[model samples]
Target: MSQNAAAATAGPVSPDDVAGLRAAVTGPVLDPADAAYAAECATYNLAQPTAPAVVVGATSAEDVAHAVTFATRHGLAVAVKNAGHQVVPSVGESSLLITTTRLTGVEVDESARTLRVGAGVRWHEALAAAAKAGLAPLAGSTPGVGVVGYTLGGGLSPLLGRAHGYAADHVRWIEVVTADGVIRTVTPDDEPELFWALLGGKGNFGVVTRIEFTAVELTAFYGGGLWFPGEDMAEVLEVWRTWAPALPETASTSFAVQRLPQDDALPAPLRGAFVLHVRFSHLGDAAEAEELLAPLRAAGTPVLDSIAPRPVPDIGAIHVDPVDPLPYVETGFGLREFSVETLAALVEAVGPGSDCPLVTVEVRALGGALDREPGTPNAVPSRGLPYVTFAFGVAAPPDLPFMDEHLAKYAAALSPWTDPRNVVNFIAPDEAVSEAEVRRLYGAERYHRLAAAKRRWDPDNVFRRNHNIRPSSAPAGD
Candidate 1:
């Protein structure tokens, strides 16, 4: 073994030792003194601070393997950051960070309708590349999110999700470097176990280096937004629930009730007061899409209507999720069915009459594409929930405690309707749900197997920042 490796094994390697290790890797190595360290650590979401003991700007898979080897040898923790949208804190504390942002590249095979993307490439980057070949992947509303992170977390896309399914359903293969510092190519045919684990498994199994997936031929959607006045809350919620399920598979929609902060950047009508914003996307023609959405559109005289035939990349404008980073507290639950009674309860809790001045209340219909089994053999616990509803609480100066209380009450009120199954993407840090709740999110059999997989792949519990599954031998209730 080398002197640096021996020294690392003995104790925490000093800064000089880290420099020696950096000399071995091909990528840019950053320490505290590095001028670009702060900028490099900043995420797109801007909420997360990527303060790492060491940051490796991985330009290739080989570079990642080197970082992994170095981290494992020194008994250091590791965090893989791409777009940094998952702003949960302490995620990258005193650990070695492998930032994949520089690895942004995309390649498309037109005839195969498949695209291979670098781990750091964002959805918009891949979409632009795929569009050249008249193909598109099942991208989410915000195209700025990294492809590897979103898809690995069971990507919930806006394009034809009902008819097709989640973005994870279309994955062809992935290249990952395991915690043991071994580089492996994962496909359903090759390492079926790792392949299944990597999909919807978050960053538990390994650091994904490359992702290959099939794309859709879609160019445009008969989609856009419908805005309603604050007074139409009761009528709009009831009308949306009744009319939403009846719509065909070619359609997907979300109802967002929010009080847009007064800003000169936004239109006057939507600036201050609460508003019911209904956003929809259809696979077919513009006119038929309009007619199908007419009733909901006519539910209330709109303050603003931007609904029309537009490019897929522009879909983020429909929900118009706040681009700026602000302290946010969110809670979400998937329901088997949002019955009329339950809808009424929700309307009372966070709707127009409620004192909750929320940032947004979003309800996404999750049956079509998200309901089906993924192409790869993975342990995606089926929650059997038809709709997933969430409350994003963003207050001035960000009231963490109040936000938590409000969301807990909201989840409790809907407990009767909520299915235990959780999409890993929606799992937040402050959730007080029990182990039984987690078991409910992921079925009994699958959760057990995932725990088993964790035992085999990551025995020491190195990657426990995510929704963790403890090993069987670890004392239960200790």
Candidate 2:
């Protein structure tokens, strides 16, 4: 049947369609009744449920191409899932989801100082592989996040970001299966516009199978976190707000106000209590790092201090973000500056005395290398923004009804300092982001270019499961 005819039928997918896909691809095909269907469709963000009509476990680029071609031929939308860390709902009930968990491969070249990683490869695997060669790829705080998805959203690494900018800027090339079902190698020289779109465009244009990027040398850095009593939140944040903007590019830092569950699983100092965590990472010697951090340390007595020299693989320790997947709601906004008033507003909303249900609220300092443009232009937007304020609340079944209002109250409190533009990587799972919001994420010019590229590469809008960029010729509502 032709794609148009198949789409017009609009009934449940038949067994014949699944069988056809299974025959065309080397990987396994899963339907609702399949034994592995649930596991294959599980996502890291439990709040965002995925109920795809079919799931394809893609093992290679050829597998990805086959799946894309099959989906197109069957008139089904395609959604790609790697580590399932994406907060946005990429896969839906009627979609054909391609899971890249089996594409776990990594190659590190010490001589070239570059890492080639498959779509399934997470930061931990890449970090371990690069560590063996005395190098490290720019990765996020959570090591479990898939490298491709994170980098495509303009990965803001916990460390080295102030020195090296975003991970996307370091990308050398990518191998993607576009909507046309062709396996193409994209780079600055090979499909310049597509390459630019892929850099920070998320999964709008195509499905990436593998990515290669320049890795940095030096396997160790001086970094970690300092924990203060909840009563000292004001003092800690004050010191951080003043000290952060003055630091050199070698230093990157963020401060979080966290209310931990009173459970034995947490450390004694942090168990069942609210505390202020001052996380810092410096790409320098211990003495230099200490000198730069002394003022913040002297602000108040710390209950726990873990700052010291550490190997590159231990970079995740800086933020100490939760490694395991759980249900939560996250939201954030960019800030042009963080003044005393902004800090006060934050304290009033989610601070020590506030009856906030949020697990953590943080503001990361942005600037330094992040403000500078890359050698090659990419789609990463709002680089000039100076700070990003984010907060997350652990979702309990009872709280689901009020979670949106609860989170919105806190976000509104910070509105005076918050900018409409936010980092694409930090968009929350439940946020009802619209096309105008997406256009603002990328500036007007970059958005237009991205739309033009989408028109050229995916005019059919087959890859509409992400922070979508509609084709130029499409109607506004379409």
Candidate 3:
């Protein structure tokens, strides 16, 4: 049996084990008793907690390998964290967490139109580097999110997705350290199965050290936010439902039903307000975008209009996601279609008079290139999904019942239109998905393929934390 298989009898992680890891790694290795352990494991979402027996702050791929090898020898499962936006709380699980916050690096090839980033690099860092090269990557809404983790979960760029497809679809290469503690450079041409699986399998396969992906040629785009009064939500949504579907591939849109806090940091109009925020990003000139946006703009007068021509780095302003760590309950899933019925259901669930405690209920239209297959196919299951919905409720662990009740109600309201496929990044940190649900999420064929790859690379399942994709030897459904 593998060392990981014999781990149950290995007892608790000892001080000597932590000391050995600290000596082997170039970065810090802290246990629960260490003074710096909590901060080392800090995540973007303060609500999601972790309790690793030992924390390995990996500075390089070699450090990651050493950590992984040590975890295997000690029979400890490995959990990885970088930006920690999608952290799955350790709770009762005993594992060694590898923190990749120290592996920051960025490089752009203007001639090749590709970018290389360390696993620790955030989207903002990469965006700035690519902006200097007159190019842009397919980054997600929050710039604070780590590039490697997001891309692995099929990075959906609010600005580029409709035209360019998912960030995973454009990936050219991946550098990962597998369960066996060997760092490998993976691509479609080399280690094809591992490449396909890692792009979507997440931490189940191994810890990705670095990645290289293609970037678009353009730098600037016409895009921004438009917030409307909460009372006029139905009216604005009706116009948007029809207007957004007719948009060209060059344009993308989504709307959020926000219950903003009365924070001093917020703008005057949005502070302590319930409003509908419509986000638009178009790869076109101002005149053309304005013409396309006429209907929604004319819908019951917007309270705030910040839409304009902005540089690639300013893309985060479109969603305006919180940068600091805060307690919140978040989850997302795909939608087969957002018909009139779906819109009505949404309005009834979180409209003006509703008592919904969720901070933001968002729906993004997905189609155009997003539905099509890229040159080299990947494991992204949401390809044909017409829409993707994300929602979050501001609440700490003690307030779980309050947040969870409304979240459940909101989900039930849209259950009729819910699709099984979802972006891995958008999954809830606390979600406990069944094996059958996971199979359905990826579809039987794809899940089987991923499981087979996991069997090959990590048969012992050393990396079982996060949204685990088990290295099952049986068939997909079995």
Candidate 2 regions with alpha-carbon error over 4 angstroms: 1-12, 88-90, 475-478
- How far residue 345's Cα lies from its native spot in candidate 1, in Å, is 1.7
Q: Estimate the lDDT of model 1.
A: 0.75
Which whole-number lDDT from 0 to 100 does residue 185 have in model 3?
A: 97
Clashes of 1: 4
Model 1 segments beyond 4 Å from truth?
A: 1-10, 32-35, 44-50, 92-94, 396-398, 432-438, 473-478
Taken over the whole model, the C-alpha lDDT of each candidate is 0.75, 0.85, 0.87
The model with the greatest TM-score is 3
Residue 105 error for model 1, in Å? 0.6
Better of 1 and 3 by lDDT: 3
> Which of 1 and 3 is ahead in TM-score?
3
Worst 10 residues of 1 by lDDT: 1-10
**Residue-level lDDT tens digits of model 2 in 417-458:** 777666788887545246787888887889999999988888
